[model samples]
Target: MSEKPLESFVGVVGKETWWSRIEALEAAAAEGRRCGWAARQRHAIELTIARLLRAPARAPNAAESEIVHLAGLLAASFRGLAAKGKAALHASLHAALSGDGALTPIFHQMRVAERHRRRGFSVSFAGLETGAAFDLAISRNGARAEIVCDVLSAEDGREVSRQAWRQLADRVDPDLHAWLAAHPGRYLLKMTLPQGLRADGGGENASPAHLQARIRTLLAGDARAQQDETAVLRLDPLVLAGTDTSQHGLLAQLRGDFGPEAHLSVTVAGQGVFVMAARAAREDDVGTALRRRLAALSGARLSGAAPGVLAMFLEDTDLAEWRGLRETLRLEGAARGFLAGAEARPVAAVSCATRAELIGLPVPQSAAGGEVRFANPAHPAARSPELAAAIRSAE
Candidate 1:
């Protein structure tokens, strides 16, 4: 080979690298801050694929640590896709894994590990497809292992999805529902918009009618619109209100539910479930405890325009005591300002024996008081399978 020909080829190869496309995508995504999560994730997937292809070309045999890290990253990205509801990517990944011998099992393994909240995995790569002329083999610990491109972190992906939902809530200003309740005179909605009308207006130009329209659209889209709308009407303690009408899965898994020293967590639904953990000394004590627990259980952050249903789980032995306690607690809640609206707070208090009993609890027979009503949660398990499994495992 002539030295001149070899030098020209080296320059051409260096100039036309695969990473340039990824760089352009990254820059464009950065330029558009308001771009949706779906757009951002597409760029991420492409960038990751470019990086993976580069890895095999630079060195076919990568360190186990390097492979693990890469695999973990890719797994996270896959999770991000899942979180975004991008079924196409999932289908593609499965198709790629099953049909093409270009990728290894490490991608699937890493995804499994992330789902289970594991740190490391034993990985091997049989073939790494780069679309180049040569087929590459990746090894770990003197064995064949392939490390393909990784996606986002599974945990991070969840956070991203959460943030997206939060953004959507903020854009429509769901908190304004509480504000509207407080200042009804400020923005009067004299004309009622048609049902199924969603809010589209924003800024100072937007009237109260527009805001109401938006709230209506958002609530209507929600599966639990009726319940949430009721809670929004009584939004005095805005910070303590349960904004998230979505299922909480198991309340027991979260450490933030209890005090730092306490190791107890009750697996309540997202709407919130309050267990009569320890009996109170006096009639007044249960009210005090209920208030404190309600505040603790319903996080300060408002996810929507609703107060979480504060259900009290009770055993057969405590029925009579709880019956008397319920009235006293309800009275105390009203007096103490924990319960509000035409609906009685205590009336809404659902009594159940166990989590299983909570699954198919019927609606209260009598609409006796303006008490908050409790019903069976639409979804008992968490949104993510891994998280749902963890909750079940804890139980």
Candidate 2:
């Protein structure tokens, strides 16, 4: 056994071999319940990490990629860390490879790209850094209309989007207010609020009627909040789509306002997903936010799930931020502290710009029938196992 190569052992493993190895190790540890058993498991995990670090620094093919991901998964199971611990481990691996070359920090780059994914006028408020901007686009039968408003203040808070807009009023620059007032009939003020805000009791408080009522009351009771002319600013429910039934309200209002002729599109940035909808004929830009969000989530989910094998997927990755990873990991003779007898972990990850690249990474099947066992359910690739299999079979 000691004379044979590591790849020789791993490469010959059958479908159940990886999981069986993990289960046997775990059962042994549980049966003995001894400190020595736990210690041995830890040592094995450390040894595995060392082997991975010392492995030749070349772009791995599909088989080698499977080995890395499997190795990481097996090591992680041996350590018996919880989900949060696994998350930290996943994060640390990426961090180690971050400064090596042109590699982008996986999470950081996803966030930046996610911020810019929307297709509309991006509005930044004065004084505040341009974080993520809310995108709202309205199209009539005739033309497309867009407006960029700097978010001055959402209820006087620095982070306008995070606060509950119950009794709050956003103080924008006078110019923004003046511009909206000028187009009272066409452009109306719609104060955006964070989603998932629960009431004291927690059910239906975040509903559309409740939110609309709150917005109305806030604007009415505050003498200074009202504009000189318009009574209530138009409510763009597309902006509120994912925030419970509030989106339905927006849809109803949109139908009433636009009738059968005009089209309205709204996209609100949510965590990892974008809430987007279109009425009437759709345009090419409609799916921009959703596509970007999917790509970002897929990259994040894949990296967190399997950091060891993540390096295998970086060959086609853009080198702008990922070059450092290759440089660091490929360094010759550097004392890999954790890789030398000490317990080691995986490194950071790279990103892909498209769904095909993300879903095309090698996946371990649970059965000979080709059922994918180790992908995020939300991943677009996981949605159609047949298609994924066909694609892989072709490759």
Candidate 3:
């Protein structure tokens, strides 16, 4: 009996040689097969080729020779295709050879498409130390867009410049409605910080509620322009704001309106709120206590009188101590009480987990007319010794 050359070849290549043996098996399957078998063999070969071609170069111990062999096989499969198939094969080859890193280029091309869809235009406004400037542009095919520049330093100047740029950009692409429709809503709302201004904590100075309010304002404008009847303004305070007492309060309010099990994180300084909660809690489930405290102060008002504040009118010592007494809340956490001041004395005072909670309480009025009073109404200096101890310890 004469030996089969392909079978002999496969025996030499061993099962451990996956790439070489796969080729041998494919060649064997193609020889003297029925029409259906031939088609199945071809399909299997094509899929194997694709899988090999798409394998990332970052894979450990991958051989260059194996990759080249796979690429050659794929090229042979598409050598005589018509224009559409050829174009698709070319794009696939480009994507496969470039590996996962090719996504960046793909994204850039999508961005170009997005720009073109908006009547070939884009704009960026960057705030500078001295002032802010708008760079308007008209996109040219396969080239850098042309820029129309304007700068503004004074508050008045910035507003006028912003308005002018808005008018121009609108004429180019009515409110960039097409562009916005293509991108995620959150991306449009992100506030990009200017260089050097990051030292001010990159909008950390704005409370979560404040940031949400700003986003609501912008989204409202977009909705009005689009005349979107079904466009509902969904403000997610927990996601927008860093984890602080204010964020906690906002989350509580949202939960009250929405429901529990809301998968949200309120952050402070861009750090995860879980860390803040962990630091503040004496146990694993202190988050429940924190949420309850936030819910308790849901209707508290803001005063805007101080750089930071944490005002609460709790009758319970445990609630007051747990919510009202933190040494340093992140700027967002503290800004909740920026305007709150008191005309009457606080019944008690103590530091809590975040400064943002202070905004929920009324400022204490002083009996001495200027001195801040910190006696619990139940204890009032003449009453309870434990209250005095708690007050002394707080001081």
TM-scores, one per candidate: 0.23, 0.19, 0.16
**Model 3 CA deviation exceeding 4 Å by range:** 1-187, 190-386, 393-395
Candidate 1: C-alpha lDDT: 0.30
- Between prediction 1 and prediction 3, the one with superior lDDT is 1
- How many collisions per candidate? 21, 17, 25
The global C-alpha lDDT for each of the candidates, from Candidate 1 onward, is: 0.30, 0.28, 0.28
Models, CA RMSD each = 22.6, 24.2, 31.7
lDDT of 1 at 34: 35
lDDT of 2 by residue, 66-170 (tens): 434444332433244455544543444334223321111222222222222232222121111222121112222322221121111111111111122221222
Q: Once all C-alphas are superposed, what RMSD does model 2 give against the true structure? A: 24.2
Writing each residue's lDDT as its tens digit, candidate 1 over 1-395 gives: 22232223223223343244445555655642333443354333344444555564443222332333444454444444333323443444444333211122233333333422341223222122223111112222332211122211111211112223223333434344444454442221111212111223222222334434445654345433222321121111212234442224322332234322121112122333322111111122334444444344334311222212233332111223334444444524432344343222212122222111212223232113212233212323223232222222111
Give the Cα-based TM-score of candidate 2 against the true structure.
0.19
lDDT-best of 1 and 2: 1
lDDT of 3 by residue, 163-263 (tens): 22222222323222433454333221212211111112233222223333333455455444221221122322224343435655755654454332122
Candidate 3 Cα lDDT to native:
0.28
Question: By TM-score, who's the top model here?
Answer: 1
Candidate 1 has what TM-score? 0.23
